[model samples]
Target: MTKYSSEFKVKLVNEYFDGQISILGLSKKYGMPSKSPIYRWVHEAEANGLNYLITKKSHKEYSQDFKLSVIEYHKLHEISRLDTAIYFKISPSQVNSWIYRYNHYGVIGLRRRPRGRRPLMAKKKKKQTRLNPTKEEKYKQEILDLKAKLHDAEMDRDILKALKTLRENDPNSKKQN
Candidate 1:
């Protein structure tokens, strides 16, 4: 129910890393309902620290053979996602996703796919509306659409919250005072 700033989360994770306190200790000290978030933050901070020095390019394509090998190695040794990713020089989430795909869809799932925006995303292949709109304009329009959707979702959330409050405050429907 409560959201802490990134700075605050990083501060606590750093303290844990510095041996000033444990995850449970930090959670208890801060009166948090659970220690899981602190643990997650610590892991995230560690991962970021590990990647800080590397100049590795993001979103590199991997061969099907390499993906299969990574998945096989992971299963053969029963290694954690983080450990497998460390061994293969890929992000942990990517390794997990590839494994999930392979498990559900077999080898075909591991085949590389195009990354980034597809040239044709719209359902209709209508002619260009504007006179050769730039790629930046297309991206900006997508961003604006997403923002509007987010705004609408937030309004729905607020309306639901208000309704819940009204229900809680309603009288003569259940136990009387």
Candidate 2:
């Protein structure tokens, strides 16, 4: 896929919004084969806070479990794709695509499939690689994250309780309600 500069996308999107030309006209003016790419770019800019789309690509492999875990984390926390992508060290668009794939294909969609010729033998595994967190460590980290979330929820509940008490005690607040 051809990578377009973020500035180029924003310029076209601004032009589209400026009402200077129709979508079809913009496409033709830019030597685009169709209007859809421009439309897609503008839509993405609006949706994702602009600029960052698919950036430079380099080959990287993620484990199926890791992919599913990232999606699961997203579903559980309801975090934004941009945040999730940052936490996962991937592009936001990639996380968005994963969500789409998971919705359509389930867990099977996340499994890594090699595109072409296979190696004669699997590459020798490295010891204590920085990338792979052990299962126990992952579980512990998840537990800690959940605990923090729970603490925040409890604090919110306490604050709400205090506010309710205060409102009940205040004759002025009751009148406002």
Candidate 3:
């Protein structure tokens, strides 16, 4: 659909209220394809003043639950999209879009998703290594690493000894590969 400027909408609405031409006449005069937009503009202007006809810079974001309720209300009342839009003070096209999304994807469709490409993974920091360590530091580090490895090996040996005893005691237990 063509997007008309707020000024153009106000002018058309004013002309409509002038009592000189009907909506169809104004549509023909202005070469608008449909009278629905004019009707909507007039309704909005009358209900919420001319300022409401202006497109807002920041569109209102509806929550997923709010969208679900709107869809439920529309369905429960069996109302047209235009009527639901008017009741909710939202655009008819928005109502239609929500309904379409809800029908196609269930409630998850109403959820808002981040818009854009995914960010690249962060680079891992490099570990700092000592270029030349003193003999004492080198020996101490080697001792610590060897101690850790020895402790791990001792733990594994003890666990294996326990498992072997259990298997020997329980002759019915099958060995697992």
TM per candidate? 0.47, 0.40, 0.61
In terms of lDDT, model 3 sits at 0.78
Q: In model 3, which regions exceed 4 Å deviation?
A: 118-177
Candidate number achieving the greatest lDDT relative to the actual structure? 3
What is candidate 3's TM-score against the reference? 0.61
- The sequence of per-residue lDDT tens digits that candidate 3 reaches over residues 133-157 is 4565455445545655676788899
Positional deviation of 112 in candidate 2, in angstroms?
4.0
Order candidates by lDDT, high to low.
3, 2, 1
User: Model 3 shows how many backbone clashes?
Assistant: 0
Write down the lDDT that model 2 would get: 0.72
Q: Write the per-residue lDDT of candidate 1 for residues 22-68, one digit (tens) a residue.
A: 89999999999999777756665576563332334464778866886
**Steric collisions counted per model:** 0, 0, 0
Which stretches in model 1 have alpha-carbon errors above 4 Å?
A: 1-13, 27-57, 115-177
Candidate 2 structure quality by residue, lDDT tens digits, 63-132: 7668777887786677877667766767667799888976765555565776999777868864754344
Instruction: In model 2, state the lDDT of residue 160.
Output: 100
What would the C-alpha RMSD of candidate 2 be, to one decimal place?
Answer: 9.2
True-structure RMSD, every candidate: 16.7, 9.2, 24.8
For each candidate, what is the lDDT?
0.69, 0.72, 0.78
lDDT computed for candidate 1: 0.69
